[model samples]
Target: MRARFEKQLLTLHQELIEMGSLCEEIILKTFKAIEKEQLPNTKTIATLSEEIEQMEQDIESRCLKILLRQQPVAKDLRTVSSALKMVYDLKRIGTQAYEVSEIVAQGHIVKSKELHVLQSMVDSVREMVTMSIDAFVHEDEALALKVIAKDEEVDENFDTIKVLLVECFASKSLDIEHAIDLLMVSKYIERIGDHAVNIAKWVLYAITGQLDIDGGE
Candidate 1:
């Protein structure tokens, strides 16, 4: 029974990795669509988000099954419980990516220097999500801590964008509607970064039995 349970845990880990890869693909597509001054493909992003939702449910069920049938103890129990917690963060990341895509579809691209700044933030968050998943898969607490620290850069980017938008408003230089839409997009991206940090924190918990590193950006 223990051997079977160990196999199940490995399987769960692989599924989570696959789900994380899908999310990275979705975000990549969304970002490229915007860079080309094209409306994001909402239908495609939505489809990916739906797939993530299903994966989350499936993984959660698998975790619960192992907990009930195997009654995992000690480190095994922590691993299973951490899997449960991380799924929620992963689901939110997918949802936020979809939300950003939706906003991009609604937005008519604003020609501003601020757009480039926002793109940097988008890139940072993307890296965070990727690294967080990698940390979990490899059980690398140091890498996980690095992911947690990267959130600060995301937060800085968000604040800089907000300040730039406000300056545009004060100078009467940008469309209010376009500025608001971009602001919303940046906010979604920030939230996605927060979720990534949450995932890394759970990874830390799984490995070190510590939960204090989730101090937020």
Candidate 2:
């Protein structure tokens, strides 16, 4: 019975990794679409989104099964609960990527200095998402903490974009619609980083047997 329970836990872990990888792919492709000023490849994004949703459902079902059949306790219970939370975070990240793709499809292209800043910000968050998941898979508390710490950088870049966007709106130098779309794009990227932080928190919970709301606790 113990061996069977461990096997189920491993299955859950693998499914989480698959879902995280799909979300990362969507984020990278969405940024590529933005950089090229082309409509994002929605077909791929849609397919991945569907796959992620299915994975979330599968993970939830398996977690419930484990709770009922095995009655997981202590660290095992934390692992199952953390897996549930991580799937939700991954699903939100996927949604944010889809939102960005929709903005790209609307023919909004942010150019010049602002575009560079936005691209850099996207790249940072993408890296964070990848690192946070990797840390969880490897059970590396240090890497998980690093993911949480990097949120500040994402926030700073987001602030810079907001200021530039406000100035553009005030000066009437850029199309207001375009500016708002770009602002939303920045916001989506920032939210992605926030989701990555949430994943890091889950990783910590799985490892330390404690929950930290502030991430530093």
Candidate 3:
């Protein structure tokens, strides 16, 4: 029974990693659409989003089954529960990525300084998503802490983008509709960073059995 339980746990980790990869891919597609000033195929983004949602449901069912059949204890229980919570954040990240792509498809084009800051935000956010899942897969608390710390950089980038957009508005360089779309995209990116932080915290919980919202600091 114990050996089977362990195998199930490994399967859970593999599924989580797969779902995280899908999240990363969808976000990158959105970033490319925005950066290159090209309209992404909305159907492709929608299909990715649907796949993410299906993964979330499948993982949730697996976790529940493990809990019912294996009746995990202590750290084992924590690991399974953390994954159940983690999938929700993963789903949210995928949903927001799709939303960002939709906004870009609607002719929202960023340029110059704002684009540079936005690029930094995308890079940081993608790293956080990847590292958070890595931390969970390896049970590495330190890496999870790093992902939580990185959220600050994403937050700062959002602030810088907001300031630059406001300045453009003041100088009559950007119209209100375009400014709103850019702001919406940045806000979604900020929320994705927050979701990554949540996943990292869950990683710490699965390892230490304590959920530290402040990155264990």
Candidate 4:
């Protein structure tokens, strides 16, 4: 029975990794859509989002089953509870990617000088998503801490994009409507970064039994 329970936990971890990989897929697709100045194929992004949402439900169900059947105590309970919380972050990341792709469908995410900043932010966010999952997979608190620290870079990148867009607006150098759309994309990417940080925080909680109360761990 113990071995069977352990296998179930292992399967849960693998499913979480698959969900993380899907986030990687859609984020890369969204960035490429921006670079090409074209609408992202909504069908593709939607499929990914649906899969992610389904995984969240499945994982939550499995966690409940493990809790009720195995009655996991101590660290095992912490791990299962943390998985439940982590799925929320992963689901939100998928939702944000869907929003980004929808903006692409709107035909307004045109070529912009500020796109390079947006690309950099997306890259940072992608890294955060990947590394945060790695921290979970490896149970490495130090790696989890690094993922938390990296959120600052993503935040600064978003701020730079905002300032540049404001300057463009003030100088009458950019279309107001398109610039607004671009800001929306930047904001979505920023929120994705926040979700990545949240995942790392949960990973930390799983390992350490607590999150950094002040985000200073």
Best by lDDT: 3
TM-score of each: 0.95, 0.93, 0.96, 0.95
Q: lDDT scores for all predictions?
A: 0.87, 0.85, 0.91, 0.87
Instruction: Give lDDT: candidate 4, residue 96.
Output: 86
Query: By the TM-score metric, which is better: model 2 or model 4?
Result: 4
Cα misplacement distance, residue 176 of candidate 1 (Å): 0.9
lDDT string, candidate 1, 92-201, tens digits = 88888898888888866566787898889889988998999889889999999999899899999899999988898898556878888889888988888898998888
Q: Which candidate is the best by TM-score?
A: 3
* C-alpha lDDT (0 to 100) for residue 38 of candidate 1: 85
> What TM-score should be assigned to candidate 2?
0.93
lDDT of 3 by residue, 1-217 (tens): 9999999999999999999999999999988877787887778988999999999999999999999999999999999999999999999999999988898888856467787888899999999999999999999999999998999999999999899887988885567777888889889999999999999999999999886664321
Q: What are the per-model C-alpha RMSD values against the true structure?
A: 1.7, 2.4, 2.3, 2.4
Give the poorly placed runs of model 2, Cα more than 4 Å off: 214-217
Candidate 1 least-lDDT 10 residues: 208-217
Question: Which portions of model 4 show Cα errors greater than 4 Å?
Answer: 212-217
lDDT of 2: 0.85
Q: Give the per-residue lDDT digits (tens) of candidate 4, residues 1-217.
A: 8898899989989999999999999898877888886778989998999999999999999999999999998788888898898888899899889988887688876666688889999999999999998898889899889988998998898899889888987895568777888899899998898888888888888888996433321
